[model samples]
Target chain A: MLTKRIIPCLDIKDGRTVKGINFVDLRDAGDPVELAEIYAKSGADELVFLDITATEQKRKTLAEMVRSVAEKVNIPFTVGGGISSIEDVDILLKNGADKVSVNSSAVKRPELINELSAKFGSQCITVAIDAKQVNGEWLVHLVGGKVPTDINLFQWAKEVEERGAGEILFTSMNNDGTKAGFANEALAVLSSELKIPIIASGGAGKIQHFTDVFLKGKADAALAASVFHFKEIEIKDLKEELRRNGVEVRL
Target chain B: MKIVIIDYGAGNIQSIKFAIKRLGFDAVLSSDAQEIKAADRVIFPGVGEAGSAMKMLKSTGLDKVIPELKQPVLGICLGMQLMCRHSEEGDTEGLGIFHADVVKFKTQLKVPQIGWNRIFNLKSELFEGIKEQEFVYLVHSYYVPECAETIASTEYGVEYTTAIQKDNFYGVQFHPEKSSDAGEKILENFLSSPSLLK
Candidate 1:
């Protein structure tokens, strides 16, 4: 049986973890690699490193971070943010990232997804859609949710799958940073609509939210940053909770 | 012990290398036929289209060298598929070591059955300490049908061979490097197995 995945995402800025991760064991909250190792120890099925670094020189620092993380972490690792071309994906993959997620760049040139997926297998390419409900319709957003596009979330999702994206990271911008819950309604629709695995991102507040996303939302995976970054929800405890709820998660 | 991972410009080679390194063994990633043949164990790992990968192997003359290898060779993911007799992916011809044909999954379920799946009815020293129905990660659209070479089987939509063994050759459809502790155990089993050591 394919077990439902639980992913922890870390936002990295200037080669350091952006958020003030307050885990007691994790003394250096600034180092992304240390944080990744901690998460893997906690039984995180996968880890996503979002290179929140803005400048060009700092992007190089992100690559260094990836190399460091890849060397120590044994689990599947994904790198995203500022990844636009095949070269960007190449740098990360060469550094041992198993998968690369593209968001803003993929939206600007939808063909970028095809290019990346073709050069690398679709299994290595992840298309992350940052969308928010507007006028009762989910609209794809770009530039870190600063601008909304005319593309419908469902239509873009279908296109990415057609273009050979192995997975879709659908982030509900409205629910982001809200700590309310995932956009289960939209995730449920996407689960039924797409053949590929849908990784539900954003609005993950508590352990029940993870359960809700998996059950009610029908998500193949649920990703959260702050919840896992802080000591609020330990991955080991969360997996135990999910198992108690009858979710087929690897324990 | 020397371990060489055949690199034909495929993805996920680094992770495999790191996985071996983590197991307290040095792994060399190379396309050199001599290094692969001389190594105590070889891991043929790939993640890409079947036809193109096979073409690269032939171009590098690895296709000829790989099948002739005496050391225990472990094929992973697409590497496993290429060891079969044939693959529906691009209608490509494989190395013919497994004596089975790889076919695409046609079902109501997804094409690439991604994530950790359980393997049961285990056989072979490759699964030495691993338990029945223990989870190993898998990410592939094509799979080899159950055959005499099959050492382990997994079901997504249909029963298929997830692990295979034929004399000195072994193959697994899952990415052992990325499958966590259970994955590590499988790698350790392959590395320390008496048959693999000269």
Candidate 2:
């Protein structure tokens, strides 16, 4: 009886939590470790900390932040963004990250997934695909959704699974900030096509969107940034609403 | 009491270290046979393929040392699978502490069953004070079938052995370190259970 997971993603910039986190405890939420503790207390099944910093010094800062979060938080958490080599994965996992999500680097070298899965099992690797619909066809985008590749979403997802990736985190660039709803149709296609779990990301606006992603999109987990960051949708209330809607969420 | 987590180039050892620290015990991560044998409690955790892991253990002489240990030894995930007689994964032979076989799930269900699932049929000191049907985090492709050595079982595609006990040795297919409060309690019981201490 594996239950669907609800994950709140925190973006890190210059070693601090980005995206003005507007919550009851504003002061404590400034620190990534403190915000992670808050989410762990609120019943977040898992957390994703994306280090959006681009500088080398800041990357070192992100590692320190990960270590601090690992000491305080007990639940499984993932660290992503700017992770290119096996060394990066080693540092993060050694710092207590359950899984590492790779988007741009994985797209560039498909064999990195194989190397990672062979060295540290597939369960430790998560391939995050950022896709944008171009003239009715989803194309894989890289460099934080600025550069687009000719790779098709479905075909690339299947390839990722074949390459021994444990899970796929599919983010829809079209619906990301729009927040009207998730890309349920594309998500359903991904769920049906792959044996590995699919995590729907980007456009999660309301509580209904969470339910829709699980029920309609058939996603195994739903990850959001601003909605949970800004406190527009509380994880506690959203999980309650999900359980009421007949989804098997951890209470 | 000193806790030693066996490190044979496996994944997620840090989380286990953190969990032990939270329980107010200092855990030492080591692959040295002397350190592992000297510890009061030894935790054997794995999150990789069985064949390669066993090869590392054999090369480092940990395979021989683990079974000879009289102290309480707990195997987690691939660690539990490696304690069995055999595994379908890589057709690899296990350490043979528990008389069981790890086989691949041959059902229509998903290959890698991931997430928190309830474990019932508790009958071991490892589950003391833990309620039946309490959820624990598990992420594995293969499972140990129910056998005489089984101490706790769970229903997924079918009823399978999620926990096992044989004298001083214990094994669990779930990740107790990552399983929130219920999981922490199991760790505490393993550290404090009187029967295990004896």
Interface RMSD of each: 1.0, 1.2
DockQ computed for model 1 against the true two-chain complex using alpha carbons: 0.76
Q: Model 1, range B4-33, lDDT digits (tens) per residue?
A: 999889886888888888999999889888
Q: Which CAPRI quality tier does the interface of model 2 achieve?
A: medium
Q: Which pairs clash inside model 1?
A: none
The stretch of ten residues in a row with the least summed lDDT in candidate 2 chain A is: A21-30
Q: Candidate 1 lDDT, tens digit per residue, A1-251?
A: 78899999988888888877887876787888788888887888899888877786865887788888888887888899988889888988988999999998987888998888888898888899999999999999998888989999999999999999999999999999999999999999998998999999999888999999999999998999988877788888999999999898988
* DockQ-based class of model 1: medium
* B89-159 per-residue lDDT for model 2 (tens digits): 99999999999999998866656777778899999989989999888888888999999999999877899
Once fitted onto the true fold, the runs of candidate 1 whose alpha carbons sit more than 4 angstroms away are: none
**lDDT for B185 (candidate 2):** 95
TM for every model, in the order presented, reads 0.98, 0.97
